[model samples]
Target: MKSLTLDQLKALAQQTSSPSISIFLPTHRAGQDTQQDPIRFKNLLRDAEKQLLGSGMGPREASTLLQPAQALLDDPGFWNHQQDGLAVFMAVDDFHYHQLPFSVEELLIISQAYYVKPVLPLFTNNGHYYILALSQDEVRLFEGTRYAVGQIDLPEKTPVSMEAALRLDDKQKQLQVHTGTSQSGAGHGMFHGQGPGEEENKVLIEQYLNLVDTGLKEIFREQQAPLVLAGVDYLLPIYHKVSEYANIMKEGITGSPEHLRPEELQEQAWPIVESYFQQETKNAVEQYQQFVSTEQATDKVGKIVAAAFNGRVDKLLLSVDAQVWGNFNPETEKVTQNADRQSKQSNLALLDFAAMKTLQNGGAVYTLPQDEMPTDSPVAAVFRY
Candidate 1:
């Protein structure tokens, strides 16, 4: 499955096509739920076919368009490695899919443009995050959202253990190579002892952590997602000193991460990351309220859509369940609101359009439910200027 990135969203936003098929469904990672994945996909495919046919495509042409999605239904292996949600997009010469960490409601929308609203949350600043679980015995990285988590492979240069990191010279060999943990109930690894042994071990551990942090920086350079460091209490502070990632949270899961599964790590780390997002959204809402009567912010759908397209919006608060069916003319900078979302109309979700444009221009986006929206209107925005 493709990892959905900002570039992918930009590409989709720029795409103008007809009879685009967008399908989203909740997927299972394991157990009996896996058995139901194929069946559910078949139903979505049939829905797409019906929509395609309703748009005046012949039966054979509609079948041809859906052929790629149908191939995935019979693939048993793909379902086994899934995350929490699956999104599929099909159009004229374009097909893309993403395995996301949050579950999405089953939705199918065939329209003039691809219905990307279902996956828009993933493109937002607070959608997902990284968990860097560090330990001398094992080092792991996890990519997670509130609903699902998955491990990411570390760089080859990362040290496997403390011994692997420090190569002692012949003079340092005078220090004893003790293996108390290897033969006993303690964790298996080599330990070195010397005068002021704790200080010496801290030095070596710092060096090892630096390597891990360097590797992590390479991976997270382009990401604004928060990184939570999970390890024993003692190890966390030292790693923080060496970590270069600016978004690392002050609070982390305190324990050995070696025994904790990826989902378990996610369970521990999500709250800390989520609190940050919650506070950010709250601050944005307060900012909008403070400037409610000013030109710096607005909740008018037409004005918000125009500002978003012009890169004048600094933040957007969109309702996930609300859709203002409309179309925009870039040449005229005019937006037309439709009375309803009917098939074959030049209609797209204005809420989605504002969110996408805000994100594409490096602005923040917060998607709330209809009840939780910042404004009584369908959308709200904070302008850049």
Candidate 2:
């Protein structure tokens, strides 16, 4: 599966194809459960074929459209290395799949466009977060969303290991190892006193962290995503001191990350980002409520959908349990809300469309339960103007 990226999302959003197929399935990274992944995929394909046939497509045409995805059932290599979920998109002229870091609800949609709402987290503040795992031996970097984490490679010459990044003399190299839990188990950034002692080891460790921060900044320069650090209890503060990245989270995972797999580290990292994401959405909701008396925000789906198409939406909060099925004509600024979703072939998930346009036009989108919204509406927005 191809790595998910913004370019792919944009391409999917800009697609003007009919009878598009989008499929999602929860997947296992490894273990005995891996065997079930292909089986699940096979079932989803069968379901997609049934949907296509029901949509009035000839049987051969439907089979041909699904052929690419059907080919994956026999590929064991693909099944063994999945992330937390999988996404597949197919159209007459397009076919691609993304191995996602977070689990997606099992779904399949055949519509005029791809069903993209579930994957929005990967593109917005809700899903775009970073992880910096530091240890004496190696420093690892990962980009994560709400539920999944993927390791990102540091640039060439970036200091990944204490040995590689440090200029320690032969004596220091051998002694440069160690960490210890506080006797009380109640401290952070706590260095293990091993070879020379805590004071001397801290000096070297600080230098190592500085190098990491500098290298990371090259990639984080234009990014607004919050970053979480993972390491021994004491090292977090040292890295924080040397890092100028504005979004380093105040909280972090306290442990050695050197040997932890990316998914293993994700188990520790998601809560930090999820809390951050929730607070971000909360703040946006408050802004919407505060500006409700003015024109800067609104909960009306009609106004919000139009604004999203014109790039006026600064942030959007869509409800996962809601759908306003309809059709929108962006060129004429025309839209219709359908009480019956299946009454017309052109009806769209209007809420999903707004979320897609918001992302496409460089705005943030959050999917929250309806009760948590700024108003009782299924959709809410803070405008750019």
Candidate 3:
């Protein structure tokens, strides 16, 4: 799975191509559902082909354009390993796809440009967080959204266990066989570590954590999502001390994570991340309400859209599930709301336009539920002025 970034979103927004093919479908990571993934993808590809042909494209041209996506269906390796959702976009000169950790409704939209609204959730404040579960005997990382969690394969440099980290070649050589009798009176034996002292073990664990943090930095470059640590109490602080990520939460799940499943860890970590997002949105909403009477805030979609384009918007609050289909005239600085999509070339996703512009201009965007939007209107903004 490829990591989706804000830069890629900006580039997708700026792309100009006719008859762009966008396909999104839910995929399964395991079970019988895995067998159904390829079938779903093939169905979407067929629909995209029909849409392309209906848009006055030649059958051969449609086939040629969709070839890359079709090939994914036949590749056994691609279908065997899956995420929650797959988004594919194809143009005359550009073809790209990303396997995302969030689930998406199955849909195919062939339009003037790619339909990227589905991918917006990744950038929204309600997106994903990473859970790093560290233990002396085990280390694992999981990418989690509110709905699902998927474990990421660690790099080779990431030590999997204490013995691995200490470079102990033979398990038997490092173990001290205990033949003493148990308190229950039954004869028992155990394997105890014959290597490193307590202080030396701490040093080795710290070095392992440092390596993990280094690898994570590369994965989290330009990422805005918060990171939650889930491990035993002692290990958490050491990781915090070694981690370079600024978004690591001060609060963490305190317990031995060696035995917990990824799903179990996600269940515990989501609340911390959820609380953080709730607080952020609540503060932003309060600020917008307080500034409603001032020049800094407005609920009018036209004004917000214009402000977003001009880089005057400091923050934008809108409903992610709502789309105000319309067109904006850049020359006249006018916005017209359309009752229906008239043409692919003329009609535009106005909310998407505003969101993209706000993001590109270094403004913060909060996506809330429709009823929870800061204003009665679909869009609202706090201005830089």
Candidate 4:
């Protein structure tokens, strides 16, 4: 899982919508008794009520929030139905701000559960040039209609001389190159000014361009990949002029020669790719937010989870650093925390739950690193109805 930067999170936050309900469940322990003690159950409920009230919920709202447990409370058969359980539920917007129930622990858990993941970027071999892809999370070496083939390195740091040339294949794909020679002025003017300098320079450039054209023709016989001119900035224009006569795509040429090794260039190009994808991702998120905010999209975690259980989820979003520690029944697609245990696994991390639920429903899960999560609403999600 790739970690996301803070900038990514801010972008995502601008797109997330608030959920309808947020439930917080504490851990519980099942005793060895076959029968649940009535007194003990009542006391547990009372304790839960006190905690909810302290969080600002009125008695009525808190009671209504916990109404789901009423079935178990009234029916002795339901009391001991599960091994042992202790949890709390909260409905967002149902209670006023002053009547809301929230704890520092809950806040911390939620924060950790909502981190996002970052995407890798693509770059060119030449340090001077780069391209960005459309996929926000995925990056390719080519951008627009241009694609990269392979790069080469010269034995010497500087070429004795530089030249340009062009070539055309049967398929009409144009190829060009700016070649360098070890001999100074061998093709043009030099100290000697005697050798077939101009002719030799012309030949070298023509041969290089021919070789490039042949390779491209064989690789993409029926189709044409855009041409790229890379070497020295001075030679690019020369190559362009030579290839101008061919049916070459004007957009294929790189503006300048690369100054760094392939590896270094790739590193530098990543930022450009990221920027491109960021814009696209932002646009999609904005659209999603608008739809969700209008109530056309269901944004609640619980509802999403329930929908996922029914195998209706399309996409799942979560933070990579998010940890879920809890007891989950895969068969029922239900989740509950192990509040009674101190171990991390029993704690039921919210992000983990979202991932698990998403997977169970055959939905794709995307976990973003903390920095990559949305700034406004970092909560993980299952996108469906």
Candidate 5:
């Protein structure tokens, strides 16, 4: 099933007067042992509704009325629900007030499930802190001990007193850097006229560049995965310098690293990386559309019909709101709105005609909503030479 987006959920909530409900059932045998049958489940829900009505409550309050039923199922003393693996029921009133069941384990599973999918977060820093090893959809973090499996140890370089290291694991398809700064020796050197003068600044910059180069080379040598540069703005220039020497396909640096903790950073970065991948996919789709537009026989629909009649259309594009009805003769290049039995009777609807012509001639058809359609023209087709 396709994943739901925030926009889609908002639209759905607006359409339905009542909230959406989600139910989770454990597939493991322990939970299944006490699982209610489908028939019993329906009957219980019906009874709960009847009880609500008996108490002079409206149908809208049925869920509140059914709390007792849910409690009974979740009761630890009675059912040991948590130990046996629990189920979850959620009703989303709005985007913000989506309520989940009380089980921590269940909530964890739901959170992880959502995180496991590709997400696009607008203000993320980089993919390195976000993406997990091996899995395209998992996030890695330090607090949870979710470190990349083969993380390399980067000892602190003395001149700069910064710990910098690269981790590369090809089998996991992950590359990352662990970086931290130590107290500068010149913090109080100004009193003794030993402060980090211009020379010291140069030394620091050089050390930073060296660390970045080492990290970038390790990533390129191992996986050739896309580069994700994160951390403070001050550190971003170092990544830019490294990019000059590396074959980085894409890169981004975010403004804030919300969670000072490593684990939190990982979670925050996942969506940003996912968004980058989504944008790339959308670009590919647009390119294919441009290719079709370029190969079109003529700018007019009439010419497109002629090409279709000769089974020459390679692809077709049409407005979702378009209305067309016609039959065409391949040999004569003539189109008839209404054909009799004497003329070869064609049952192709306008939309179907365009699609069939394109497919039969080794092409594809795309339909877009009226608002989304690239052109106001009724129909367009690409033709083979």
Candidate 6:
């Protein structure tokens, strides 16, 4: 399964020649409700078909537009394993489906552009994290959100197996094992000594971990996200001692991850990451409040939309329960908004627009419940200018 990424989101955010259909629904991982997942998807498609026809599209054309999503109903395999929610976006030439980690309210938006606010939670600062699974034979890296985890392709130079790495020429030393440095995968006991010199086993395992950490140096350089390791208990501490990665989590998934699947790794990883995200959010809110009476921060939607587009927003907070229907003229930096949703699909969700702009300009975007917003406004920003 592919994780929902920033690039993919930007692609979906682009304007298309045809109307875009965005649909979201809660899903069940198991039980009888798994059967109901597709049924609900089918219902959403049906609603879309009606809306498409009502928009002056012919029946045949409408069917063709929805064919890709409709095909999912019969794929029992597709529905069998799902996360907390599902988000689908379909246009005349594009179709994408993401398995979400958190529940979403059932929603259908037939708009000129894709409705993306429903999925913004997954893209917030500290929202995307990584899981590095280590075992004696292989190293697996997964990109995950709050509830979903998907394995990512490791860089070629990275070691896939500890045994394979150790197999390199015995005469020529593999790597200088470092000691006393602190850091933090599937932990199998190939090195755990039950029958031999325990001291020798520790040295070999540390050497393997040193090589593994060196191999991952490139991956760690590009990321500031938290990393969770899954492996045996003893190996866990050894990894911590050799890792150079900045944000390795103190808690780890114990037991060999050799046979465990990505979802299983995610199940054990979320509780550990949840506290980190929550505290980060709490700190962000506190920062926003500190600047609320200053010129650096404001809840004014008009100023936010403009600042976001001009690369001035450093952090954006949007109300998950609200949308300000409007149009923003970027050239003039003017905002025109409606109090409620408008009938025309061309009307923009200004909050969504603001959030996207913030992300595009290398700023962070977070969704907060309406009651948690610093001011009573639906949108707020801490600006660079």
lDDT of each: 0.78, 0.80, 0.78, 0.36, 0.37, 0.79
Q: Candidate 4: lDDT over CA atoms? A: 0.36
Q: Candidate 2, clashing residue pairs?
A: 179-192, 188-233, 188-234, 189-233, 189-234, 189-235, 190-233, 190-234
lDDT of 1 by residue, 1-385 (tens): 3456667777787778777778898998889998998898899899888877776789999888899899898788898988788888888878888887678899888876777777876656565788888777678887777777766666667766655666656544444423233233333334565544656766777888888887666567556678898876667888889887888899988766788888789888988999898888888888888887999999998899999999999888887777888888888889888744653354677778788788778888887877987678878889989
lDDT of 1: 0.78
* Per-residue C-alpha lDDT of model 6 across residues 163-220, encoded as one tens digit per residue: 6777745432333222222243333343222333556657777888888889877556
Clashing pairs in 1: none
Ranking by lDDT: 2, 6, 1, 3, 5, 4
RMSD of each: 4.5, 4.4, 5.2, 21.8, 17.9, 5.5
Q: Write the per-residue lDDT of candidate 3 for residues 1-64, one digit (tens) a residue.
A: 5646677777887777877778888988889999998998898888888877777889998888
Listed in order, each prediction's TM-score against the native is: 0.83, 0.79, 0.82, 0.31, 0.28, 0.77
Who wins the lDDT comparison?
Answer: 2
**Candidate 2's residue-wise lDDT over 1-385, tens digit each?**
3556665677888887888889999998779999988998999999999988887999999999999999899788989888888999999968999887678889988888888877776666765888898887788888787556766658676897877888777767656455666776533454443368767887888888888888876667545688889888778888889898989989898877777788787777788778788788778888888888889999888789899999999989888777777788888888788743644544587888898888788888877777776778889899999
The superposed Cα distance between candidate 1 and the true structure at residue 286, in angstroms, equals 1.0
- Residue runs of model 6 more than 4 Å from their true location after superposition: 126-128, 138-160, 163-224, 232-246, 250-271
lDDT of 4 by residue, 273-308 (tens): 344444444543454555665443444555554565
What is the C-alpha lDDT profile of model 5 across 329-384, one tens digit per residue?
Answer: 65787766532112124332444345444444445444544565445565665567
Model 2 spans with C-alpha error above 4 angstroms = 1-3, 30-32, 53-61, 123-128, 141-223, 233-238, 241-245, 259-275, 339-343
Superposed Cα deviation of residue 88, candidate 4 (Å):
36
Clashes of each: 0, 8, 0, 23, 2, 10
TM-score of 5: 0.28
Query: Stretches of candidate 1 above 4 Å error?
Result: 125-127, 152-222, 339-342
- Ranking according to TM-score, highest score first: 1, 3, 2, 6, 4, 5
